[model samples]
Target: MLTAQDDLIGHQTPAPFATSGAGDARFTERYWYTAHPIDGSELLFDAGLGYYPNKDVMDAFAGLTIGRRQYNFRASRRLGGRPLETSVGPFRIEIVEGMKRHRLTLVENPSGISFSLEFEASFPSAQEKQNYRERDGLVEEDLARVSQFGRWRGWIVVDGRRFNVEPAMWWGQRDRSWGLRSEMRTDETRPPVATHRNFFWTWSMFQFETSALSIFLKERSPGKPHYLSGTEFKRESDGSVSHREVVAVEHRIDWANDPLGQTIANGDLTFQFDRGAPRQVKMHGLPTRFYLKAGMYGGLQGWTHGDDRGDYYAAHDVWNLDDPATREVARTLSDHVIKLESAGDVGFGISEYGVATGYPLYEGPQKFPAL
Candidate 1:
């Protein structure tokens, strides 16, 4: 569903790196994606995760898998000035480390799959959408089905006016084991990050001018794929709207493992997103409890397979600006608005946000593309 001259996974050689210095971090994991209370009539798909490390490294994960029936189609579309998105089907996700070799997978649930999990997707607003967390959607400890065939597509409607994306993608059936990923740098020879696969953070990312909106996910101690991480950005803009750089990032702790650290009121709050305006927005999130399920991906950090759990709504804000170094920018409402809703443990939100991003455009992840 995308048309790029180069592979979404940048063609680059792997480079050595370090994660949390050298420490013995042993992790054990087990997963079971069972579909509980088998509902063969509903077309269940459309979920994913996004990851952002610092401001420069970005990647997302999306997939479309069916649970019942024979086959299905899912697409991601943005309507209303790139503010709202309609994932017209299942998950629109891709994964990327440092390129190397990324994998893409499609699913059609038929056997038995039920796992408690959280989901995040922003629409109508870029700055405030921050991909809020949904307590439970497809996470639980129960029996589920895995369909025979499943299909996924990405139909992006950028600019908020009409179709502004040129898409050309290579898609196969739901039978393959590959996964999709989009990256700015691809280290083909690297080990972990360059494997082009993220068993953990699998989601999608988008940048408009200096404004960036990235969404990803990770399972927590009790739930698999439980927490949703979002990085909303805005920057000084030149003219013409879409060629600015992302100058800031908003850093706020939404959730934590400690029950005493779950609420925004009890959690740490600091604006490390920018250096301009001293701005803060209040959030009235849904209840912190729910009944959900989760899925395990081999070895993970946050959860195990078919995990059913609950937590507080952590944090929520309408419009807040910050700088590239996680510094606060200016108090500008020129970018976003927010709304929250709930149906018991489930949460619903609509954000109308955008930002002026101004990061230097690099031609090959190193040198800036000469104008």
Candidate 2:
């Protein structure tokens, strides 16, 4: 059951900006957006912005993957002004119509990538159930997140060339989440300890010509089972949306070694909705990939608030494409465009798979086991 406060706290329209919450340093607000061509052009672009209230820090990243090459841009700074007026160095985000529409703009940065894109929701934003959990002296409050499927309108320029973005050709997904995440460790003296040994998370959004489907899952420690799962399907028949809690899930991942010798996995996923039949989906890796290694653009191994040096500073590292090791790692972290076959209908979208710890991809005792 839900209450009035749930509606007030979960919706994005009324609260389009960040709020000072009781969680302090753990309180974080962030946005992730991705756009890809539907005509199989093999071009992918993604960007994300994160704000930490307790630390008064803001960070943003943008990446473009073309052919077998990937370009990344990143920036971080101390929060100086209003949170709603989004601006971080050369990157800026504008909320055009509260939750219904938003715009992301990036001027030419050191990475030589710039874009002006607008995301308008095709359906009302869907909020996940309040995720409240207490374990091992840690208490997680209303860790609320909302997601929406939408189309992109604007243009993206790479180097000096311009590519126009149209709704008919380009579609994307966006999500806003605020809460205490394990990745928010910035304090120097009091470092965050590992809460769990290993966790597997997969988030996917499949967009069809007239409908869309989104699925989310999280598995901890012994990766054979999942701890949480949810699904949302919007049908074209009457423009109605159906929400279901996934009852069970089964997946298989084909493992490969990256340049750094780290294991990466990509594979097929199946979901069983509580009210309906099962759905099958296959994920295919793209030639270009995002390297999130320790010091790399999106890697969590580095601290965000330290002096601007080493892994702490926002920087881009190009891979040695000729080297077999580097090429293997890129193949592991690369984005996967997925194909879905369900109920005699087909759909296409992006898929994200990650493993925080353990080597479930290999046969061995896990490196980090729960205490």
Clashes of each: 126, 5
lDDT of each: 0.21, 0.62
Q: Which regions of candidate 1 fall more than 4 Å away from where they truly are?
A: 1-108, 111-232, 235-274, 287-293, 297-371
> RMSD of each candidate?
21.0, 6.5
In candidate 2 the C-alpha lDDT for residue 233 amounts to 59
In terms of lDDT, the best-performing candidate is 2
Worst lDDT 10-window in candidate 2: 362-371
By TM-score, how accurate is candidate 1?
0.24
lDDT of 2 by residue, 55-146 (tens): 65677777776665666777777654444446777888888897789999998777678899999887667776666666687775547888
Residue-level lDDT tens digits of model 1 in 75-130? 22221121112111223223232111122333322222212222111112222122
> Which candidate achieves the best TM-score against the true structure?
2
Clashing pairs in model 2, backbone N/Cα/C closer than 3 A: 258-328, 258-329, 259-325, 259-326, 259-329
